[model samples]
Target: MGKRKRNERIGALIKILSHQPNTVFTLNYFSEAFEAAKSSISEDIVIAKKMLEELHLGTIETIAGAAGGVKYVPLVTPERAGFFLEKVCKKLEDPQRIMPGGFIYMTDIISSPSMVETMGEILASQFLNQEIDYVITMETKGIPIALMTAKALNVPLVIVRKNSKVTEGSTVSINYLSGSSNRIQTMSLSRRALKEGAKVLIVDDFMKAGGTAKGMMDLINEFKGEVQGIGVLIATREPEDKVVEHYTPLLYLEEVDVKNRRIIIAPNPKITTKI
Candidate 1:
């Protein structure tokens, strides 16, 4: 590869490393892909690490022993996360996003893959050590984020359905009020989906009245599973009593000025200590 092309490859690799910390790669892996020597790749890695640390993005950790490799660890400082969310909140600016019931409609944010992945990564970073066995979400919309979080944590996912399935031999069912509507709804789980004492994290696309969230908690309790934590993509902040006390939200929409096409969202509130 020419000098310019080699430098570009190095830069692209650095960007990939930024997101995948703790992932190790062999020198042969890069050497074969870039047609570069191990010595040159090592130098590139050193320079990239310096650039990353100087920019305060993350740290490049290098292991030098027999199984040595490189890894990037992103320490999303408080300022960084807050700033990122602030910009993300601006994307929700739509006059039609405001519902008649004084709620900010944020289905768009939940449906966007980039937004959902970012929210999942941020939440997963916070629970790096809670020994999360699997991620749990109520069926439908929450599936994407729940699946993303599960992938980030390298765990399985279990979706609670509103109805039973004929394919599953037996099922566990629990009743809880749906968040959108105050009426009670049944959530079902397959008999083999989760095991007792498994630490499960509950995540949803949005949090309004939180009835669905509470119902999820009840279903989890029924399965003999432990609720590790709860999280949501967007939350309505006017009435603090609307959602559970011990939960995390990626964005807090305090107000939605439909007439002005303005929607305000603040940084997600982090849980000081897991519940």
Candidate 2:
């Protein structure tokens, strides 16, 4: 291949780094790929890093030592997070979303690719420094955001099933009280899903009383994994206290009045103010 121009090199560098967030690409590797000198690649990295940081897209980091390389860390600025979350709150406030049982329908929001990808980036940013080994979530609803979080962190995603699957081989099951329904529920995980002492972040679609989040925590404990953090798309304000404490919720669902066809929700003050 012929020598690549500066702008061309920088563009390609950003594309590769951002595509695999948190994955390190060696300078030598770029040098070989672009048919450029290590010095030229290093300069390209500096330019890419500056542009990304200035635009609040993400950050490119250089690692030192033999194992070190350049990596991209996808981060959402607090301002950006607050703005996006506020928009979601507005969408959720539509009274039409209220269900018969006083629940707000949010399947479309959580399942949206663009929305969840942004949500995942925000959640992943909060725990980026924690060196998370995996992102965990319950089956079905939470999978999309959790998978995106895992993708942003460049880590694996562990899904806890409502029941053990024979295909998963031996399993570890746990029973916990459901905070929302006030009933005992069972959740199981594949024995080989997580390694002992792994650090994990729990991502969920919603938290009413945190019953499901707590259940996931208990399931994590079964494997001796540490719960570094918990993130949920929305949490109920009435609960005040939850089965699991110390969680980050992007939005607070204050009320869902079925009879009046009213829904009240807002971005978490903690998130907006912190930004």
Candidate 3:
């Protein structure tokens, strides 16, 4: 086959890298695919990496040694992350978003594919350098963000159901106090959902008191899996004593006034500090 042009090779390389986020590929793979030399491919990768960094598109990481290769890691800078979340904050400020219990209605934003994808990229980037085996989240609302995060990390997504289902086969269940309601609630997971000794990153759409997140950590422990990290798309600022100590929340619900129909939200400081 005729030698491919430098532009053609770079475009193809970017496409391949973007499609397989957090997956490593050897230089030989690209060289052989494009019928080019290793050195030439290396130069192409350098150029591609520079462009990606300059544009704040993403990052390309190189691992050394014969067993290692280069991988693409998705990133959303603090400035961009803050800007995007600010837009969501504005949308949520509307009085119509206020619910009966002082909860802001965020179903529409959480369900939006574009919004979830962006937040997922930001959340997943935090755990990319770690040994993450699976992405776990409670079923329903959290599923979308968790699924997207798992996609970015190239890992499996596990759902912890609110109610046990016969279709899931044998399952493990646990009871935990509801942080917001001050009541008991039950959550369950399939016995086969995660393998023993796996490291899991928990994702959730909203966290009020973090009782549910704490329960998820307990469930992982029961299965002999390690809790690698916890992430919430949005969390309440009040009731600061979260049962789960460590977590990265994209946005924080600072204040909500039902009578005035007012809501205050901002990017979580953890997003800037951690990511």
> Each prediction's Cα RMSD?
4.8, 1.3, 1.8
| Candidate-wise lDDT, in order | 0.75, 0.89, 0.89
Clashing pairs in 1: none
What is the alpha-carbon lDDT for the whole of candidate 3?
A: 0.89
Stretch of 10 with least lDDT, candidate 1: 266-275
Model 1 C-alpha lDDT per residue in residues 1-275, reported as the tens digit of each score? 33335678678678766555546777666776777788888888888888777875756777788888777655445555666676677767556677876666667777788777666766776776687888999888888888777766667878888899988768899888765677878889888888987899998877878888888887888878888898777777866787466888877778777667677767665622223
Which order, best to worst by lDDT? Answer: 3, 2, 1
Ranking by TM-score: 2, 3, 1
Lowest-scoring 10 consecutive residues by lDDT in candidate 3?
Answer: 266-275
Residue 79 displacement (Å), model 3:
1.9
Tens digit of per-residue lDDT, candidate 3, span 1-275: 35788999999999999898989999988888899999998999899999998998898888899877788888777777777888988998999998888877889999899999988998997777689999999989999999999989999999999899999999999998878889999999999999999999999999989998999999999999999999889888878988888888888888999988889888886566543
**How much is the lDDT of residue 76 in candidate 1?**
48
Better of 2 and 3 by TM-score: 2
The collision pairs in model 3 are none
RMSD of 2: 1.3
